[model samples]
Target: DFFWFNPSRLPSPAEWVNVRRIRVKDAVDPLWWMSKSAYPKANNRRVLEKYSDSMIQLIQNGYKAKLRPSGWDISTKFQKDNGGAIPPNLLQIANTESNSWYLRECARSGVRPHPARYPSRIPKFFIEFLTDPGDVVLDPFAGSNVTGEAAEATQRHWIAVELRVDYLIGSKFRFIRPHPVLAVPAG
Candidate 1:
């Protein structure tokens, strides 16, 4: 609705595979998980239970616990005191965005930074989130095959499909060294 040039059209959008169980030791811990802390929320369950064991606990105990403004602890803001890991934005006090969060990474010169293709981090986030090592990720509309590169980076197997041969050919650059030098024929 806010497009200035293409006012009639739209602008967009990861690479998430369907959910699966975690059976491998190498399952991804997520960038956020790695960046901050993971185990901190464990004590939250105990805190809620400590309020009391009766249906009338809130009425009886005077509500010792408090919920965040949104009242959904999963997107939590409660104080967890069990020495667990801090949340994703735990360290960075200033970077919180008001609307939403997006993961971004530098793209290769040509394969992405374009409307048609996506940054590898887009695929990287999902590959790490939904699957483990050796899990298979399939991108039906591969575009420049960013998902394939992300899969390889995350140690997951990947399958890509792009109807255009030129895209497929260009996609190969993703696997190559960032910059390569080829020799010129002798004149």
Candidate 2:
């Protein structure tokens, strides 16, 4: 779900694969919109604006929409006595974390950090919202296994696959005691 190119360079809707027609049972029904966080860069403003507009259009087109605060707002006067709020389509999480445990471990081990490692909050948010405990979570392109770590913390079984050996090695540091079955064998 990560896109490396700039928003302006994104593929047009016509050029992209249409998976909307695919049917799934209730067991694995995906949310109407997949939530994502983006870095607040000046160059990305136009793209983000357009994306937001499209999301609004989708809602107008009969897609269910819900808005949730990214996290707790201590100063807010309104309080919900029930469950946590529903997450919004546009996630406002900051992606910067130069001093995280993963980064520190990578630094201590002399391993290069994944350039595009997203904040754990991003995955944790969606996982909590869309899935229940004990559900299986899969991250096919797990760069540093942030999603795996979040899933494990939330009591969910997880599978993380990485293409690069170096990144896979560094990702192991995220776990306190690596599970034998999940470990990548040395070549």
Candidate 3:
């Protein structure tokens, strides 16, 4: 339901202004501002701070933020049952973990972990919000296949496609058993 790109690669402020101008034309709903996976460098922090300040100003100036009418009742019910407010788009998950199972498995097997692996929380958040328990999830760029792990943990069926065989092999550490269906191109 939500599309997210890594925030580390966001353009500088001047460029982002132009980018926002273009995005606004096609934007129908609120822009969710997700936090970075890792703690941001000073420059990136400054950029985020500026953006946050601008948003605060807009809100103080009486910008009327609207929730989707269809989901309003559902959101209220979710909040009531869950005893927590709906998560703001500014996700605060930390991407770095020195001793995660994935890392420990890679170390045990002497296989290097994927350099660009994102934390499972990112996909887990969206999956919980957007899909029901039995839905099918597809992850086309399945680096370390964290999305697959998250989907399976949430009782969703998943298909993950990764071009790199090494990464795909390593991703298996997250699963209890080998996938029932395995497809590889004939050499």
Off by over 4 Å in 2: 1-84, 177-187
The lDDT leader among the candidates is: 3
- Order by TM-score, highest first: 3, 2, 1
lDDT of 3 by residue, 18-42 (tens): 6555432221223232334444221
Please give the lDDT score for candidate 2: 0.61
| Candidate 1 lDDT over residue span 12-62, tens digit each | 211132234323222222222221234432222211222223434434444
TM-score of each: 0.42, 0.51, 0.52
lDDT of each: 0.47, 0.61, 0.63
lDDT of 2 by residue, 1-187 (tens): 2222222222234233234534322211122324243432112221222334444444445433334477644332232221223333555555557887778888988999888776686677656755678977778788989999999998888999999999998898788665779888999
Q: Name the lDDT value of residue 87 in candidate 2.
A: 34
Clashing pairs in 2: none
**Predicted structure 1, TM vs. truth:** 0.42
Residue-pair clash count for candidate 3? 0
* TM-score leader: 3
